[model samples]
Target: MQTAQLHMTMTGASEPRTARVWLHRYATLSAFCTLVLICAGALVTSNDAGLSIPDWPLSYGRLVPPLIGGIRYEWTHRLIAGTVGCLTLGLAVWLQFADPRRWMRRLGITAVGLVVAQATLGGLTVLFFQPPWVSTAHACLAQAFFCVMVSMAVFTTPEWGSRAGIRFSGARTTEKLAMTVVAAVFLQLLVGAGYRHKGLGMNWHLAGAVIVTGFVFWTVVRALRYNATESGVAPAAIALGACLLGQLFLGGGSLGAKLYYADAPQPMPIFVYVTTVHVALGALTLASAVVLALLLFRSEAQR
Candidate 1:
């Protein structure tokens, strides 16, 4: 028993069960809430409803407004954003108390700061009547915040903590591939954000799609090739591949729906759903890439 305790302490894996439970729960909740917030933001963009309220931190000079017309989408988005901010704040505080790793506590602090900045950018988007650049920045920052929450969730997993000292062979190649995938995904997301807001980078976004897809597939292949030796890599890589495929399908559907609406000049319900979902899936893809990269390159004890 003493030997086990010593070994666990040396491995930095001596988390109490209750603390781990709370931290894991908070992390999962934060990640889910962040994803929902991203979806709401996408809906606002797809519906062209960012300025529907015409107010910052309030809707029509009131706390609660009737959920009618464009106000429904815009106000709902604000509400969700506020909820996500609170959840992230609570998560950060919880980590400060429950998590043993200094880096994780710091990550929580950074996430709190990001949520505040993201909210401020969101307000700026409304105050400035949704300037293309400001709105694009808001979108980009939201993705960053989402990535942070996802990382928190990953860090709280038992598997992550237990694998601290199990260094995999071929880690260099895995690191390079993971880093490339993450970089390409983020660059593609930035181009997508710009294109979504102002249509200024449509060509660039299209070009980036090709590059992101190639890197994503290559990363998956690399992980799978080493799966016999590194079990965790294959699962994460496969999940990333699934997200990439979903994004590609949504992208195609969005394009088709847009072209159809362009000629028909009619309301296309599917178009909004497709485009918004595409945006959400893009964020998911970025988060997955980041998680895979961190898992491949960094140990839990290192964090």
Candidate 2:
């Protein structure tokens, strides 16, 4: 009888563990799909397809439209966005039932809310013929939604819950600096988005880039120097550093491509590719800084 009871206890315990693992994996998948959706959105903007469909919640008065010219890019972006919305909704529902943490459940709900807002903004961008401010907000909100999805993915990982008590000196300072870096990166993204939509000038975006790069380096160097051995801190810091470097190169390439294609009747393929990649990498840089900041804060809390 004792053996049977023990077996049942083991089975019951294993189920929740299995569920957590699946939940983590699902969250990670949601984050990845969000990134892909960002890329698709970037592609649409780069290809000058924002108003190709001339309709929202439907393409050309139908669920699917004839995918031709810029219509292809715009329609594909919409389809991918729809898929992301479904994934986010599923993730939120799963977290509500399966996760024990109240904050995480709340975060899932927030993710759902952000996705809804993002979709609405996307529709508005089309309906209003891509007004600069509206379009820039749409771009910025996508980055925010991406950050939320990434945070969920990181929080759900087993490592996040079971992290060792790895304390480090100056953790508070590191956390503050990391938070600064995140803010800088986000602001730079805002400027870049504004520049892309022509609401702001290239000079403002360039100035923001320089400021952000300095902040990123400062945070990264501090984390690596002091918290190099911390479980999550070092890796996230390294990623942020790498992403910043890549973004710089992509930024230069994008500038050159834009100038080269300035006289072209339409956006050249090279221009589209470079600018889209720059935008995608910018999203990645912001996400990396966010992860690093969160991990730093978690470490400080554990201390």
* lDDT by residue (tens digit), candidate 2, 1-303: 434433443455665667777989999999999999999999999998899988888998999899899999999999999999999999999988776666888999999999999999999999999999999999999999999999999888866654423354565777778888888899999999999999999999999889998889988999999988776789899999999999999999999998988899998999999889899999999999999988877777676
TM-score on alpha carbons, each prediction:
0.90, 0.93
Cα-based lDDT for every prediction:
0.82, 0.87
Candidate 1: tens digits of C-alpha lDDT, residues 1-303: 534533563465645554575678879988998999999999888887787888878788899988887789899899998899899888888777666667888999999999999999999988888788888889999998899899889888756654444244555776778888888998898889998899465789889989999989988887778642553666778889999999988998998898888876444678889999999999989988988887776542243
Candidate 2 residue spans exceeding 4 A from truth: 1-12, 162-171
Best by lDDT: 2
Worst 10 residues of 1 by lDDT: 161-170
Residue 173 lDDT in candidate 1: 72
Query: Model 2 shows how many backbone clashes?
Result: 0
Deviation in angstroms for 257 in model 2?
Answer: 0.6
Residue 212 of candidate 2: its Cα lDDT?
90
